[model samples]
Target: MQGFEWHVPADQLHWKRLQKALPSLRDIGVDRMWIPPGCKGMDASGIGYDVYDLWDLGEFHQKGSRATRWGPKEHLSEMMQTAQDVGIGICWDTILNHKAGADRTETFQATKVNPEDRNAAISPPENISGWVRFDFSGRKGKYSSMKYHHQHFNGVDWNETRKETAIYKIAGARKDWAKDVSDEHGNYDYLMFANLDHTNPEVRADIFKWSEWIGTELPISGMRIDAAKHYSAAFQRDFVNHLRRTTFVGNHDTQPGQSLETIIIPFFKPIAYGLILLRSQGQPCVFYGDLYGLRGGPASLSRPACSGKLPILMQARKLYAYGEQRDYFDKRHCIGFVRYGTVHYSWGLACVISNTVATYKRMYVGVKHMGEEWTDILDWCIETVIIDHRGYGIFPVAAKSISVWVNDKAKGRKSLARPFDTDIYDL
Candidate 1:
């Protein structure tokens, strides 16, 4: 597991070290690995959001070094190949909404906009704009010559002359804010640093061009789009459609109760994982924090502490829990689904999870599974359930517990065969 501000080596070096673990990760049924941002951040120590140069990915002697925090270009390539060899796909974290660490600043005319209501300009356009501009003298326009001017951005947070951090919209622009963005702050087009103007034809074209270049250059399976709500959703859709690869959505780590940690704590992680990994819907992403139980650090928020039960859960998902899915979301305080196996797959499972204490549900999976016995692979509940002749059965779970019952005849038995048992009654 990698912390947001963990003491990691350069990107290349980190990848080199990570390559050794690919086989182990693959053995655990981790099909995809969503790594951090590939491109160089504003600084080598950055997490790759404050993008200084899009073209410079730890190659040139920029940001006071020749490599990003992950490592150099060569190491990254080797890491990708190593993981791919083990059948693990790499998803690049793409940050296209904003950029920081500009080489210089430019002065222009702009208007101050309300932070809560970005659509309403507080003051008229005046010659009082000062924001970072990118010329990339260190890169010397190697792979791309797309220099960033103030006009390329919709708004910026900081003003150099006044030394104040306020939302200022660029002058001479037709629209005060980008269209069709999340209504969080009235208009969430501008997040931080220089917000990329997606409406600008050149800006849009340049980003697409960079995407194409990076996609061809690196052996990646897809991208993890950052700050999607801050940009045009249509543009994001177009970019993702063009890539024709897997794409996922997420953002920077936030405080607890506002993140997946809400359901990833010691009490409910198994239930949360069961709901995601066992289902036949969106591709489930296993966070490193959850996999290894990384906790709160000085820079990062407190991650949910967990027992080392993720591997067993992952194993269950791999060997069994395949085929068609049937949702049973009509129950109160409990929701579950059944994975019906096909001719080639027969270890289908029924996953039942509940947030309420001491819950039971009499649900129907299918008529075909009548008279079959099921065992809880979680080992938390020692009881077993049998499908009735009517294809309906009552499943019981202790307070705030998850039950993943697999067919007893199935070959998958790692979780079931484990020596330890968590008595739900004790919990």
Candidate 2:
């Protein structure tokens, strides 16, 4: 799943269309399946993250995700199994920072509007995404899920302001000025984006229970934690520990009870395992945002699936690095020298390079791959020798022409504008 991971409302998947394309996915280098966080109201099995009813895996969708019915409860695990059948791993995103959207009667939401229970309810800092925050205290106020990352700039609602900031503007932030305020609490603020009342011991307990169940119940291989930055470090640590401890297959079965696993691999990065000390423990992780990687002119935009090119480039820093010793090798030619070996080199390098190309072409001025991306490359790594290209012409390729470069002179000067796909294997 190296290419842009397709995102859509869950219920919407045209299973037939996808079923037909199953082979194609494997054909590409996509063996990893990722389901984003908070699928509520989408074609998911139920109300996404905001409102959860874990029991009903059947017909779990609310609205607008998809018309085609896909069992909700087991959807995730099923997908994981499906992916595994096809040599893929299904990775789920957990928005542990919050619950689904607030219910009018939910204590956290009610307290925001009523204020009487503000002291007893749970809501704090502000919502992690600042899209929805409930007044757990039954009071009124604007909130962010966490405080470590600054979201306010001089009361101008920095969240809104940052949208116009250089990179933000490039990412399509439309508002020049936006105002947000919370008053007369009691689920008064709507910015938190479904804040989880972790402050509530009950809330924490419930989440732990469900997460534990999933860990032991689902057949999935891993989790992608969402809004992890918003949560307390201790809580995050404990939650992951709990997940790792749960057992998905022990006895939690349909016959009597079943389980997915006590723990699936939780590779963390900015969102999930930020609190975990990767140095001390071999914590798996993923990094976000390589906005500048697309600067490579048409290469990034027009890249074909499983192009060994990108994969080669990604593995370069570690594979090449010459004499440079570093700890990690990453995108942006970002390389880490290794006085000592690290899991980074042993494990696969996964980077998130978004497919926002409309603006990319304009910014790079035709010269891409020059901008700053997540770097591990301490040196300019050498490139792989082109081996083959698939998705070729309406006509068949000459078997003898297999190893010719994309710019091969022998192809009668007929270079492909779309380089098509190229297979990749460990070098």
- TM-score list, all predictions: 0.82, 0.40
Off by over 4 Å in 1: 1-13, 173-175, 241-265, 295-306, 326-337, 354-374, 383-396, 407-409, 415-427
Error of 2 at 369 (Å): 31
C-alpha lDDT (0 to 100) for residue 33 of candidate 1:
82
| lDDT per residue as tens, model 2, 324-359 | 122323423221112222344322111122121111
**RMSD in angstroms, all models?**
5.6, 18.0
lDDT of 2: 0.30
User: Number of the top candidate by TM-score?
Assistant: 1
Q: Provide the overall lDDT of each model, using Cα atoms, as 2-decimal numbers.
A: 0.73, 0.30
Q: What is the lDDT of residue 21 in candidate 2?
A: 35
